[model samples]
Target: MSTTPVNVQIPSDTEAPIIADFVEHALRVAYFDRQHWASLPSSDWDAPGVYILMTADGSSRVYVGQARKLRGRLQQHNNKEKLPWRRALAVKRDTTAGFNTAEIGYLEGRIAAELNALHQITVIEGQTSGDETLPKHMMISLDAFVKSILGALRLAGLDISRSNPQTLTEDEQPTSAPVPSNKPNKTVTVADLVSSGLLQAGQALFLSQAGKEAEGSVTADGEIIVRGVSYKSPSTAAAKALELQSSNGWMAWKVGSQSGPPLDMLRQQWLIQQTEEAEK
Candidate 1:
């Protein structure tokens, strides 16, 4: 399937309600709090769709289900005191000919399977019946629709990615590059340097370990840019390249020139300067 960007709309800045949709796929995502559930239009309740119930108290537990009547299903959930979820996200097909029970069931099953595979969040699977065969074209569309839903959830700070350990062959494993461990450096973290402004964006940095080296830079968004790839942290980049169980990127990476002092030294220097200025 072709990759396309999903458009997300936030109607109010103060509110958490969000609407994500793909103009071409007719798939729409609606995320709202429990109090705003009644604000949903009557059409959404009448439509056959999939909904995710999430805890409002910042928990990873969620309930996923398909409903022929979205409003009625949520109302039933409201009565269940055991289920402490207070927020909901729903996705539906917007078209003159709405989805049937079979189609919705298939989508619900597929979503449940994907969430289970991710193992990131606790998914409370809903009871859905029927196993209808979808056409090839419809299946492709469904796949795209699922991607949009996941993307929207991620945007909302819900991580639904697979993190399970899977065995791989030698060819499948990433090759480890040699990095140098010349002299043990002080304890300096990426966050420390960033918070102190000692490591600003667009600063050049180098990663050298196990006799291998890679050039990298800092981005405006506080991400590490290495060999044209952007990573959330230096350790992630190093781990991905070395195939190691874990890596401390700050200790392994050097700033500026290859012969320059370790990042920790720079951090220490910054700290000393801050202290001296404060004393003055």
Candidate 2:
């Protein structure tokens, strides 16, 4: 439904009413409100509100949190301001876990009622009693969720917080790092690559060659871009030049990274989970 936007100024007094303009946008998109209350002003629209905004990871940990104004809370998620994991999971297609996102976003009307009835979660005034925080609604911090999902993904050692968001830290990026076992980084392995659901097994590829053209059947015209992805063929001349095996399809696959660890480490993590589940 068409609605007038609420130009809510940051609450000057703690008691000043705060409205959800940004959130209204989200609500509009989510519900496609072209019919009911299409002409209502956000200020006078439904008042009691609650929302569950969360990000899922390969481990499938649901970071459940609530907000007095759900629209405001959801806005916080679209940006990288404080939530770093979005940069990680959103980019590298999570394959290790599954999610039913909005597992609860739609129930805002009822959930808000319940929370209002019980007085749980919060819509606290931040350091600025009046300067409105992001939605004033409570939210699940990225750090908090990472701890939960990382464990579920079983990569107890992987730290998403440490990944650099900057592009091309080095001219020659290495895909396989030295995992004490000389295996590839589990997240970057071919199987893991396959699991990412971003590429088909043996899809067109091209390893980065810097000053030279990419080699083999795959070349500059290849479908995959070397942007942040590893491109070292398991058996490339570059891999062989670096003394890697010719049959090293790992090197030939050349995703977009260079010189990291093996990609199968995450698989081992999943195995541990299966073992745990089997014993149960």
Candidate 3:
């Protein structure tokens, strides 16, 4: 699948952050501060789309819902005497061609289901009217919409990929196992690249020419952390490491086998496998 670049803008220090295509749709993320909400233009509240309420303490606690009138809904949340959350993010469709109420409802359900399946985040699904029957063509658009929202959330520094314990079934739940002795293990396969930590954990990319390497790990937050520095794009990290004005980090970095394809290829394959497993 072709990848499209996302545009993220943090307009002011006090205002909420924004991620969007600029032309068609936009998502605004903000800490649930009353002052911040007050600063928002009237348009944001009047817009129709989905919103997510999450705890500010970095716990898995979250609430996901869609709102036809965002301002009113948020006001109601504010009126609650005791609420667990102090942060919220809202996704708004800017154009008339954007999501309708029914579509947003469907998107809400699908996102909730995916979060549950991924075992990520403690999702408290708010009161949604439920799924709406969408036209077959609209499904494609909805899929794209969901992708954009997920991307925006990631860019906003939210880790939606963290597994949520409440969603796990009894059989799927994790249990403590006896530790293995420090001995020679069985033959390793390609899958071992991840499980064995050669590819995913504490992995480093070597720049043979520069004789310098940067240590990093792929994080559940959908970012690559290199030398204690986190970046949403691999190329950006590579550029920083290489001290070059710009460089494609994926191509510049090599893993276990320096002679093989770049580390990005392996990472991409790993992600594909993860998606397939999640589907099952």
Candidate topping lDDT:
1
Q: How far does residue 242 in candidate 1 sit from its true spot (Å)?
A: 27
Using all chains and alpha carbons, the TM-scores for the candidates as numbered come to 0.54, 0.19, 0.51
User: Could you give candidate 3's per-residue lDDT for residues 25-64 as a string of tens digits?
Assistant: 3444443454355555566556667777667786766677
Q: Local error of candidate 3 at 90, Å?
A: 0.7
What is candidate 1's CA lDDT for residue 6? 74
Best by TM-score: 1
- Model 3 scores a TM of 0.51
- Give the alpha-carbon lDDT of every model: 0.63, 0.29, 0.54
Candidate 1 regions exceeding 4 Å error are: 1-3, 12-16, 57-59, 127-132, 164-280
TM-score of 1: 0.54
List model 2 lDDT by residue over 23-94, tens digit each.
222221121111221222344322223322222244322223333433344345444233322211110101
Better of 2 and 3 by TM-score: 3
For model 1 the local lDDT of residue 105 reads 75
lDDT of 1 by residue, 117-141 (tens): 4555676754332244765445444
